[model samples]
Target: MSDASVPKDRRFPIGLTIATLVAFVILCGLGVWQLKRLAWKQDLLARIEVLKTAPARPLATVLAGKGDASWTRVSVTCAPGQAETLPLVYGVRDGDIVWRATAICRTSAAGYGAILLDLGVVKALTGQPTPAPLALAAPTQAVGVLMAPKSLGGDRAATVARFAADKPAPYILMVESATPAPAGITPAPLPAEISNRHLEYALTWFGLAVTLLFIYAAMLWRKMRS
Candidate 1:
């Protein structure tokens, strides 16, 4: 075909090129955002590692008696009678029902006592079975990590509130321990620590923005040439 017959339709081609640039820019922005998130996550992981290795501090010192700050690891002994065992409904598995036995530990310090420890889960045949009691008395030294109280907002508020009201006050709490210690037991070493992933999320958004810009530029180049 002749050069003039090449059909240089600026309207259609330009419009499509513009739309593609827009979409590509948006998607690239998202990808860049994810990358930024990855960096933030790495930094957070580093901080958590430092916390894990640092010397153990009392829950009161860490929290300042205020319900602020999360992600701490420490140790405490499980005290007899001081540890209240409660069943957590994790839903039915197979034909039998499964429930996790959670223990609330009271420490020696006043107003600064209390930690939640998960013992384990048990399958029930019919009615809910009573969990085996721990055999340690208060003043026993069991090592544990410090943690922020779990939030019981939204859909599960009612259920969580019920348990909170029934149980004695808590100081610092442990989550997902590997083994159950006797009441008044002391943890030999401190627990692991982790940091929040918000920074990672922020980075992801920023990365996405950069990627989108590149893609938009590429699309513009192709459109101009056509």
Candidate 2:
């Protein structure tokens, strides 16, 4: 081989090394982020467990208290015949497409002017259009968990603002049971448990980072030998 070619082949692979380092840092960062997520998820699951078994508090009382209100059990009564059905929300149940029914109870809670109520889910079978509101039979009394709306980031703030514009509380009341139960709707209670797989995800990312470093070292060794 020519003298110039020999030096070129033996020279350190600066470009490849830089690329590998960048990739390695990114993979490691992902792993660390997942670990942080694991911590947050663990705390969440514990809170859910505590809230589930606690006695149902009045909606007004729960709203007035401080700290995280999500997943809290609450009780409220809707004015007789005051249930106004809202638009259906799309959802999935047991791997099947479904629609969640909801409604607004005017002047329901003693202090709060209104509150959003999650009636239940209805299967969206093929060849069927949106189901009509179930006879506007709003439940007179409902005991359920308070859940945050599904919106994220800026959308979540906007959702809260929109719901609270007239006076409704900013949370959705997932009705577990009601006096004179709602018809044509199956109770869609919260899941018995929430899955926490962040530890597994973090391990996978860390493993990839280690694998990448080994591969890069092998390539460098081969170049030097050649």
Candidate 3:
């Protein structure tokens, strides 16, 4: 005694159907993009692991493209320059706002320009948002990984501009250890773990897309029955 067919009098929601389909496509697209990011992140993490264990090489070797430089451990002896003050980059350290100090150190190596050293966060800001440049009083024999300034929230162009009068290297060295460590500056060593959650993000987006489809189907069924 019950009617099984969808009611012919009930109008289909053309606008609502279009909107739902559009949203579904966008969500699925985001999921697919995240999958691509996952693959890239995996490769980067693997490279980082290998570089961390490999013996440190000369900074010049990597700079000249003779070896892989990105995240590679390299050793360079930094001779203190005539510049009295170093550049301070705005960044966060351990959930607190901090200024990362950077300096261009003169290297005696041939065919290589001054190496940019990321000396790590300033210990005492003393309430100054942009802390005054700290002095590099002693020469540093640094052993650290070479990284791009941009990746660490540094403006590569701006950094380059700061040393426009003098030649600076293409990459920045994240100082891990200095022979006679700079006073009041902590070493921001490379993180042992790089979090890769693209897969989880992708799954979340995909799940949402599926849920949306189910919700729309239920609604459509209810409308047809009425």
Candidate 4:
């Protein structure tokens, strides 16, 4: 087509150019934001690592006398109790069952409260039926991480009640227990703390922005030449 046949309105080209630039800028910003998020996640992972290695503190101390502070990790000895005392089951692995244990004990602050314990998975033996009352012996030490209690809204409560008959308990504990059981009862180790991908993501985004800028410039030059 002849150059004269092409619409010579400045508005169309300019509007398109501006839109493209805006899109490129937005994409670049998102990429950079992802990078920042990555860095924050990495730092958090490192902090968690330090917390894991540090000496296990009392659950009560970490709880700070608040019923809501359940995400702190702590070490404690399991008191002897009947299996029925185990709270609702959250998950199962390798044909073994796991239960949440909420232990009531007197804290140093002179108050009785409950601390969650993650009982390792237990399996039924070939001859022996599943332990009906999975009684746990007391005086056993437990090391676990504290977590916030899960919120089961009304809708979720009804849904979960179908499978888990018991009411949801407070907090979750990732524990290393000394209970005897079949293999694979031990939970997997926590992942290492570090987030290095953010830098890469940021670079990718910035590179895209640069690329878009160049493409836009080339298009503008060609249009002007024509």
lDDT of 3 by residue, 1-226 (tens): 2344545546687887999999999999999999999999998888877976788888877787754467888889877556456567776656677776776777855466577788776778734676667766434688888887666675745766676555777678888888777788887857534789999999999999999999999988998788
Alpha carbon deviation, residue 15, candidate 1 (Å): 4.7
After superposing candidate 2 on the true structure, give the runs of residues whose Cα lies further than 4 Å from its correct spot: 1-6, 81-83, 108-111, 123-137, 151-164
Give the range of the ten consecutive residues with the poorest summed lDDT in model 2.
Answer: 151-160
lDDT against the true structure, each candidate: 0.47, 0.74, 0.76, 0.51
Full-model lDDT, candidate 1: 0.47
- Native-to-model Cα distance after best TM-score fit, residue 59 in candidate 3, in Å: 1.3
Best to worst by lDDT, what's the order? 3, 2, 4, 1
59-150, model 2: which lDDT tens digit per residue? 88888888868888888877766545456665655655666667666554545677777777654331245555443555788888887776
Measure candidate 1: CA RMSD: 8.2
Clashing residue pairs for model 3: none
Could you tell which candidate, 1 or 2, scores higher by TM-score? 2
Q: For model 2, what is the C-alpha lDDT against the true structure?
A: 0.74
User: Candidate 1, which ten residues in sequence have the lowest lDDT sum?
Assistant: 151-160
Model 1, which residues run further than 4 Å from truth? 1-8, 12-18, 65-68, 77-79, 82-101, 107-113, 119-140, 148-160, 166-172, 175-226
| lDDT tens digits by residue: candidate 4, 64-147 | 564554435676554555443433334333353443323222123213233444444443322233434344432255666655
Candidate 3: 10-residue stretch with minimal lDDT: 1-10
Better of 1 and 3 by TM-score: 3
Candidate with better lDDT, 2 vs 3: 3
Give the residue spans of candidate 3 off by over 4 A. Answer: 1-9, 66-68, 108-112, 126-130, 137-140, 191-193
